[model samples]
Target chain A: MIRRFIRLLLLAALVAAGFAFWMTRAVPLDEDALAGVEGDVENGQRVFTAAGCASCHAAPDTKGDDKLVLAGGQKFPSNFGTFIAPNISPDPTEGIGDWTAAEFASAVMQGVSPEGQHYYPAFPYGAYTKMKKQDLADLWAYMQTLPASDTASQPHDVGFPFNIRRALGGWKLLFMDDNWVLKNAPSEQVTRGRYLVEALAHCGECHTPRNMLGGMDTSRWLAGAPNPSGKGRIPGIAPGAFKWTEGEITYYLETGFTPDFDSVGGHMVAVVENMAELTEGDRQAIAAYLKSVPEQPSE
Target chain B: MKNIVTATVIAGVLAGSAALAQNDGSAQVKARQGQMRVIALNLGVLGGMAQGKIDYDAEAAQNAADSLAGVAMIHQPTLWIEGTSNADREGTKALPAIWEDNADFMTKWDAFVTAANDMQSAAGTGKDALGPAMGGLGDACKACHEKYQQSDD
Candidate 1:
């Protein structure tokens, strides 16, 4: 009888180990290796502005929303619960002060945080992952120049299953694509804009609706979704809502106007305001890239 | 008949003065209307700042809080005397709920005033009091926006 009991315990242990292996294996990453990439911090700052990193990460009490001190407290509410934006500031105690460039790159590109936990898609790292290696390096360098703030990172108020970080491994496996940029594009300008919009800006985090599993349904990219803040529907950029022309879209990015002579309303007002601060050429490129994308309504 | 005519003339003058007091185009009416507009615009600015989701400056934020409080105190009597129609005339974001759910709105507005007053008082003291003052003011602003202001974004 004792022998049989031992056998059962051993079998249970084996099963648990198998499950753990399966879960971690689903979201693979290079643990021992990181590719070297050189970048220019000055140029990266421009890219950061174009990407609108500060719009969500930095609290507004300081400077313009485009300013990037990254002491995050912005709350994004969804069916899963509120995901409070994390402090990306360089404070050793409160932010990513201790993180290495490789770790940071992995978080941006692979959705893997320093402690090896899989981050939820809410971070939009799936889109960020597509960024060029050198651009990622540049952003990392630029982040280093920020003042080290000791603002405590807030815990997300997510529900039970989602609160479990392990579950995110599976989610990433199914939806997170490491290759974010489409290479060898027809036009350099279009490709550059796509790199900024998809991989860096991660615009789809708010604009794209989610599947039942809470992953972005690529089929409906930028088609619009419910506002994460519980306000109202976030209108799509597709031809249906405003039917924005290329010139109009580019002009709106530069000056915040629609074809109907209406300025941006609601959350988009802030987004447009940030976009307006970008270089005119960069704004035009973003518009060009958006226009080039295949039109598909996110259902 | 002569005595009746004298009484009728006196009544007509009194009625005309009263009508002038409430005329839409009167200076007094326009001034009050302008004050309400200023208050609404101030509240809108505060809300816009909050929605921008940036870090708040202690001094600038306190000033805004103090201004709102002062306006609320000055406007309180005017609101009560002029009633809901005055609120409507000002294009105030003040929802019908402000009058319909009178008790709740009043309670919230009073809380806001008190918080704003505390913030102003705290500013005179030192930076030590700034944090609490800002917190109180932010809470008041959020409470009202949650119920009153229409969602913009």
Candidate 2:
């Protein structure tokens, strides 16, 4: 009876081990590495602007020139928990200075760290996964030009089970997709705008609705979301409710005024400020892309 | 005739409440809250004009801007008396930080007054000019919100 009990215990241990192994498995990063892509610093700067990296990674309360310091201590409070942006500056000790372009690509595109750990979706890599390899390379190169700092990133305040990084693999299985939310682009300008909006700018990360587990519900893509911080709804830009013409939309982005004359408010103040810095062509392109996206009527 | 009596009674009640603020903090809290609501209503009118949501009428815009400026100049210290921090969180979004450093919070108040004054000056100049002035006013609101107010909105 003792020998049979010991054998059963061993079998249980083996099963638990297997489950742990399967759950902790990471999505492969070797694929789509930006090794072959040659980065241009000029284009890289544009990529950085489009990505809005400074808004997240820059030191808290920084203004103007100081924003170039990517020390990374901003706290993002959401329904899940508070997620802190890590230092992505060129600091050898504090930031991703030691990382290669391929490693950067893996983190940006696949949401996998160099050590094979999965990043929290708070980093918005789900939308970032749609970024083209060349664009990501340019972005990585541009990031290398920014000033670095030694400030340490705070660990996320996630609750139990959710805190376990391994659990994210299962979440990724359900929600992670690298393809554009919409296909069959009718024009090159629209395609460029799509890349900027869906992948680089990651507008959907804030604008799209989230499911029970906080995954982007692509079925009602860009239909608008309630502010995760619990105030106002983000507003539906879906075709059904969005009455602005392409010119009006572009003007709003550039000047923070709707066709109705409503000035931008809430957290969107920052988004509009960043958009205003982009070129007129880029602004128009973003407007075009927004208009082209398939609209799903929202609540 | 009715307006005169009502105004007198209201003035008397407000004076009584102001005297009792040291003992009953809720009166001051109510006063400050009421002031804020009036400010919001005025801002909404200006916002309507600026957004082109409502057609721009210079007279209405100037009136709204004047009201906002007047409200910003209210004796905030009297309305924000002692014992009305997060301790009395009911029906208020005023954070404890506002009281913790009175001087810094007052700067935000001053900024609001300045922005409102600018808006008042530009309100009658045409809708195009009002946009930037309105933006300045919004920025002042945001500045105060970021530092003193809770992130409810």
Candidate 3:
């Protein structure tokens, strides 16, 4: 009777292990999605500007023209651990210079690394997954044009359980969806705005609150989160809480001035710099989307 | 009875000094904000004219620029006393980084002073000139705030 019971226990454990292995497998990008789109370098610059890539990838407090160098040593402290931004410069030895377009797409859109490992959602691939393939191609092209740095990418300072990249596949399965959070687009402008906000700009990555698993709390989209630094909360920009007119929002994006003339502060300074590079129409579209998003109180 | 009275008096003195220390930090924060408000008001005048939301009155623009330059020149470190940052005191957006990185903060202040002086000269020129000068001034204000302030907006 004891021998029979031990055999049954071993069978159950084997089934459980198989399930865990399958669930943690890395899922690569769809090949069909990468077909036929050519990288347009000029358009790629627009995509890069909109995405605000340098905001994190650049060395912290990098100023002036040096912001273009993607050396990437900024440390983002989270409940999980401090995720260090990696060197993405076009240095063959240290950066993504050796990566193929398919590899890049998998990393950016699918959060799968070249070695078929799951990347932490700290990279914001969850939002980027919704981006148009054309924009991804363009952004890839633009990134290639930037100056290379030999700075090696740093490993993230995460500990047990969270440090296991395979575990992130389960998190991605739970939270990563290509669906647009906003369903109805009232107009072409709003639709464009939605694309920029939801996919390209990835405004929700910072503005939206998250659950214990670090998955974005979609119901509270654009409702703000606690500042990762723990100094204060990042304010909500949802319709109910933001209280800024579309015009005011656009102007602020353009000039970084509040209606009362207070200047932009903190990390938003880099964001405004990127926003200012975009066209007035793009800024207007962003403002329109902010106005249309579901209302939520600030965190 | 005498010993009891002595203990009560010492306790009262300690409490009084603690309250005074808290008040001092708050007062410094208030004064620092008052100065910043002055800077913002002048920037508003120039910003409005640059946007053409307010009429481009050369005299008003120049006056605002002059006020900005004047405030920028004032070496008011007393207004930013140690332990008066947002982390230490309530109701102020000033970050402790201001104290932590005082040299960087001072360099930003110097840059603001330079930009303000430039704005003063540019404001007297036509609206076209005023627009570009305001851009420089705005950048200086932005650079400092990005490092030393913890504003939500």
Candidate 4:
């Protein structure tokens, strides 16, 4: 009876390992999805600033966070564990130098990293998926302009179940959408705002609520989510909490003040400082777009 | 009775002179002047650090702490004063609330000074004691910010 018990335990361990392996398998990239776009690297740099990419990804020392300029070592803490952001710099040995443009697009739009692995939503690919193909190409081109830094990426310090990358496939199946841009075209301002908010800045990654499985709850777009950094709450910017006029929002973006007369603080302080440096038109577009979003609280 | 009358006259003269000195407007002028007051304090502290006057010198550290306290006390008020005036230049995100909620703002300003003084007192004891004092100062910042500041995100 003791011998039989030991065998049963061994079999269960094998099954669990197999299950873990299966969950992290990389999803296939659709090569044709990002075809046919006239990309401009210069324009992409402007879009990148509008999106606020450098706010989180770039090292504090570097002036900006270039997508291909990954100088890794930023730690993202979540419910499961700490996820170390990887080096996406164009280094042949340690970064994405070998990735094809389609593979890069797939990772950004589909949440699938190179090597067929599904990336955890910690990368904010969910919002990035809404980027237009031309925009993605431009971002990619701009990334290529960055000087390569060969920083070996750190491994994520996740707990047991979450450590399994294969499980992310199921998570993606439930939450991931491969489309790189929103289907409906609203006003040009709204479209521009959506592109900046959803694809570029990935604002919802901090502001939107998450589901039990740890994916973003799409139904409640920008209605404030708990900060992944485990510090203070990342407040919601929906109409309910902040019924800002377009001018007020624009002023805040340009100068970091709310209509109520409070200056932005914490992580957002850096964001506003960066926004302050952007073109006035881009700032206005973001403000107009944010105002156009439907205001609803998180469920 | 004559001695008492003489003493009263002397006291009256002293009181008048004190009032005249207080009304000289120097303090108000210092408070209303540009960002120089805060900038001066910052420079003094930096100079102290550079000269090794702050390393382990109890008296120097105490003086530095006192200077910081004085500046901290007037910091928010100056912001309110300057922010309300034409000095409210562009690139300054000082919210209008600084002037609108003056009472609560002053209270927070007072708390920050108290915390900063405590830090300086601790720092005078030793460099190692500075951390806890800094923590108190940080708490003061957070307390006021949570209520009054907006998220930049």
Using DockQ as the measure, the top candidate is: 3
List TM-score per model, in order. 0.63, 0.74, 0.92, 0.60
Docking class of 1: incorrect
True contacts kept of 3: 0.74
What lDDT tens digits, residue by residue, belong to model 3 across residues B1-153?
Answer: 999999999999999998997767776777778878998899888988888889999899999999998898777686777877787767888888898989889999998898999999999788898777877877988899898899676
Window of ten residues with lowest summed lDDT in model 4 chain B: B84-93
Instruction: Give the C-alpha miss distance for residue A42 in model 4, angstroms.
Output: 0.6
Candidate 2, which CAPRI tier? Answer: incorrect
The top-ranked prediction according to TM-score is: 3
What TM-score does chain B alone reach in each candidate, compared with the true chain B?
0.51, 0.81, 0.83, 0.51
lDDT of 3 by residue, A10-84 (tens): 999999999988987998876556778899999999998888899999977898678889999999898899999
Better of 1 and 4 by TM-score: 1
> lDDT tens digits, residues A220-252, model 4?
767887776553467777776767777767666
Each candidate's DockQ score against the native complex? Answer: 0.06, 0.12, 0.68, 0.07
lDDT of 2 by residue, A6-58 (tens): 99999999999898779668765675466578987888888887788888888
Better model by lDDT: candidate 2 vs candidate 4 = 2
Q: How many clashing residue pairs appear in each of the predictions shown?
A: 14, 7, 0, 10
- Global lDDT of each candidate: 0.66, 0.79, 0.88, 0.65
lDDT string, candidate 1, A56-168, tens digits: 67864344533567888887788889888888888887889898778887787778887877876778777877777777778878888877667788899998888988778
